[model samples]
Target chain A: MVTMRDVAREAGVSKATVSYVVSGSSLISEKTAAKVRAAMEKLGYSVNHTARALSTAKTNAIGVVTSFRNNGACFDLSAGAYLYGIAAAARRHGYDTMLLTGDDGVEAIRSAALSRRVDGVVVLDVLIGDARVGALKESGIPAVMLGSPADSQGVDVVDSNFEAAAVSLVERLYDHGHRSILFIGWPEAVYERKLNYAVRFRASLMEACAMRGLRVGAVYAHDATLGASEVIPRALRDCPSATAMVIHNDAAVVGAPQAFERTGIRVPADLSVVTVMPDQLGEGMQIPFDSVGIDVDAVASHTVDRLVERIGDPEMSARVELLDQPMHVRGSVRAAHED
Target chain B: MVTMRDVAREAGVSKATVSYVVSGSSLISEKTAAKVRAAMEKLGYSVNHTARALSTAKTNAIGVVTSFRNNGACFDLSAGAYLYGIAAAARRHGYDTMLLTGDDGVEAIRSAALSRRVDGVVVLDVLIGDARVGALKESGIPAVMLGSPADSQGVDVVDSNFEAAAVSLVERLYDHGHRSILFIGWPEAVYERKLNYAVRFRASLMEACAMRGLRVGAVYAHDATLGASEVIPRALRDCPSATAMVIHNDAAVVGAPQAFERTGIRVPADLSVVTVMPDQLGEGMQIPFDSVGIDVDAVASHTVDRLVERIGDPEMSARVELLDQPMHVRGSVRAAHED
Candidate 1:
């Protein structure tokens, strides 16, 4: 409750001098500034963030709108990692995050935006032609999408290029003499939702296979763990002739090696597996599986940069950024032979 | 901006009636309330959260202090799950969460608390004689600790009963005819830091073993995953007579089954493993290991309840709450000797 006037009176200085010292707006003598700071500290004076935000029209808070629908039921590893990245970035920039979960409807988004609870919004799992994006644009609020919709307009997007990454994995399999490859993707990404990058990756894989005269077998897994016990066996049984498999899930990859062991299949000899998500495969949890390491740290850094940029200049033109995927060839893939 | 005056004029009602309609206080006639709502909607009038918060002196925002030091690492599954539970609970209560991470020292906590950035804080991994706890209490801020410290002077705590849970598991193992068991725990929890519930569980296991005239072998794991790979093999080799293992780490349990497999040890036949964690394990990433499920949801709900109570009545005395740990028997532990 100590005001600038109290600090000035205690320090025998003018209120303007106290304000300057506290705000660091102007140069003040070191001794005077110290005196004011000591007096303010002694009086238990703290900056009122709410009042400061109201006066400056800057909340220094970012709104994170996350959907628990679609693949949101999956473990918090993926989405949580992105959020952790954003939070870390925001902290570095002296900002805080306010999470808005399960805000599906357009009205909900508009309400959140108009309420002025946050200065900007970082949206995850944004569908093509998302209502939230439209609402944010209409309300003149800065918005950044974790993934872009098919017809992106008036929104900045920062997402991993899963489709291209999938294609690259398939090409690697093809180059290694894999004539037929099995593709395991998440179910929600393939069936119920359109925001899934795994589904797009599957389509791109099939397209690339068609152009190269290759056969691609696909299956939808409810999750990575389930995929390990259920889908991997089915993939092997249905595509016995297939020599390699491409996985777009980290959880699935972790269980795939065990699945192979259960079926008495030797990795890189009888079958091969690769994953599109690399961060989930932590340093010590390596599965000897070849992978296109999706640099999660880089993805996080880029998303933070994009969200900050959008926040700083809400009127700036919307943009879609696609980062390149790097491949880490471990011992999972091998050359297929014709018997 | 359409104020209450505008709604009153458009709806042909008094300003007090419009205010009553918006605040839902002193209920107006249904017809009059509907008319006021319609007029406000037509004029695009919305309640400003900032102004409302100022008037009510309630931000409806909870602060969650999570450290990323040692066991508080970002990728720690249990820590992440705990945070997720808190966030989900806050969302269900129509509240937003503001996470404050990396606030290690007293100064950081003091800044966060005195700034009034959040209504209350949910503190995780609280240490014995923690400086942050003292600072928070001194600031008269509402807080709930995920784990109970040995000393609880001015804070509410919600934690699992580790000793009883460990004893129950030991008894179960004894009933299954296992004479010797190996207990693996986190090194940081046991040595570097003072005794926590995990350490207490180890002590109870030792006491139970002593009571049964059997010596239990124990080892400290650097982390769950590391212990899974390194400790499992060592336990088998070093304590060749041991037939069962109780693991407290979730990540380590994920690989424990695999580690046993690598050593050509059959579960239940060569060794039995039981972990202590939540039953949900994490959606989509379920490990097949048997476990004693800690009611994490209950813990989270109770913590929130206690925090709200403390916030509403600051004069209420602080207390320690220890909840029972639910045992979830899975396929890991079996009869030591097949009848």
Candidate 2:
């Protein structure tokens, strides 16, 4: 096996320089980094992961634990794009990802980080009063949470700014002269479990609507097709005075138009609607709608950067991150009383 | 940390027996497995992964690489549910999974498996003449391909039997006295790139149609709204005599009913259709259709089983496995000339 000394000699650089390049601890000039890489490739210096891990207490790998939220069944998932973002970002730092699944994310973190298989961990879909966040606080591992947790002061956290998204989306409708709007939020079970985003979005939506003198009607919609079909029509019927709808549930929105159509409600003609969802989901819908979209790539970039930074400097305090979620108005909203 | 010897002592078993339990090499009795697990939990033996990996030449983690396959952009991904199955299975085996992305699957395999970061590998949506398969063959990594490759002799292969599915679906339609069929195949580029499933399904459908003395009108439809809207109706017009439709493209089928609806063609009245898709995708569609489904759980279970078996015994020959895909007849097919 080629050693670091051999790589340093081949590149005419110091051992520390080679280490810096490999570990990504400090910024090396592109020229020097290129030279180090070429020398390592030529000398066949595949880092002895075990040896290096022991010396630096760092593994060029990030632990990512994904949690699926559905009924008891966890197979109904959509974390591919989100994970693709994190993995792409990690690869840029020459790091691989260790994936751990199942609901017991706290245990996965403990095993992976305690065993030194990963330098730090990135957890997805963090909930309020998250046990994983508590586990991280206890483990003292350099980590980042992709979803905002309830108590995230001391931990690195990045979220899509759903609080702002909810407020702005409703404000947009309020400015458009809509007073009474029905809000389709995540299922009651999701809020009961305290997924931070779903609960926070509802609170912000209601508060912002109130500030703008708007009457708000909030209802829960689960992601399943059957759940959406049953709940959306009921919500529409319950909110006869509402002239607009703001949907934060992606699955519900997929079937919401059909539900509305079956109830003899015309989209944008009688009631306007905006959504909080990914661009792809909105684009695939038969009824075009305005949306505050999740920028997965940006979220991934920020997450990896924070995790890498934490790994490099364990003493650094946690960060609060908010991603851009611009609303794309696509003719889904109309003036109130257009009828 | 509690050591392996400590676990062995607590379990009242030899250290080697404990190792066998951890490595999953031998079929330790259920009673023994339970005792070992209980002891490990009691003593908190999380297993020093790096040391164990070095000693046993096993990481107890399988490497999974994903490649996105839609027009140059990689987001048209469906590998999530498939991966969920694998991760769920790996957890059952007391192992975790390592994920790598980008189109450089060949390199990911070379580095991940060669470095012993993973005991084996699983590649999804394999193409003909896949470089990943070639790299695995040369590297001697315990691996399996989720989709069939052109040269699969020396590699473990597990694929949803799309060829059999196409033949059976078409034969069922033909049995109902439908002699003229319109087949909407995958995009030309997908077939040209030689994705095994697309090419094989098309070939099988054509051959089966010929065997039935049926006239087949084939057209390629890319998974895009524009493509489906234009191609489906055009194919319907061209195949005026065709009474049944077979679609292998998921995206095209999502929009096909609307296309037919616009052209004054009523489903199962003027035209009957069957699709090759996942049950979830078909269930989410506006127009209900019969479907031959890919059971992702079975694929995941089979892929993980073969890879684990190979990891336990490297000399084992490559195996070919096919998953059973039942067709769900959902009122999409009707007798020819019924109208």
Q: Could you tell me every candidate's TM-score relative to the true structure?
A: 0.92, 0.84
Ten residues in a row with the worst lDDT in model 1 chain A? Answer: A68-77
Stretches of candidate 2 off by over 4 Å are A1-45, A69-77, A226-238, A256-266, A283-287, B1-46, B69-77, B219-235, B254-266, B282-287
lDDT of 2: 0.77
What is candidate 1's lDDT per residue for A1-339, written digit by digit as tens? 566688889999998898789889899999999999999989998876676676676788887787653253465445656666777777777778777765464555676677777887778776655667677668777777777677667678888887788788888888888888888876554335665465567678889889888888887667546356677888789988888888776667666655665667788888877787746545435457778777766776687778788888766778889787788877888888875
Query: How much of the true A–B contact set does each candidate keep?
Result: 0.36, 0.34
Scored by CA lDDT, what does every candidate get?
A: 0.73, 0.77
Instruction: Provide DockQ values for all models, in the order shown.
Output: 0.47, 0.35
Model 1's C-alpha root-mean-square deviation from the true structure amounts to 2.9
Q: lDDT tens string, model 2, B146-181?
A: 888878868999888988998889988988889999
Q: lDDT by residue for model 1 over B27-56, one digit each (tens)?
A: 699999999999998988877777666567
Question: Candidate 1 chain A vs. true chain A: TM-score?
Answer: 0.92
Candidate 2 chain B, poorest ten consecutive residues by summed lDDT: B69-78
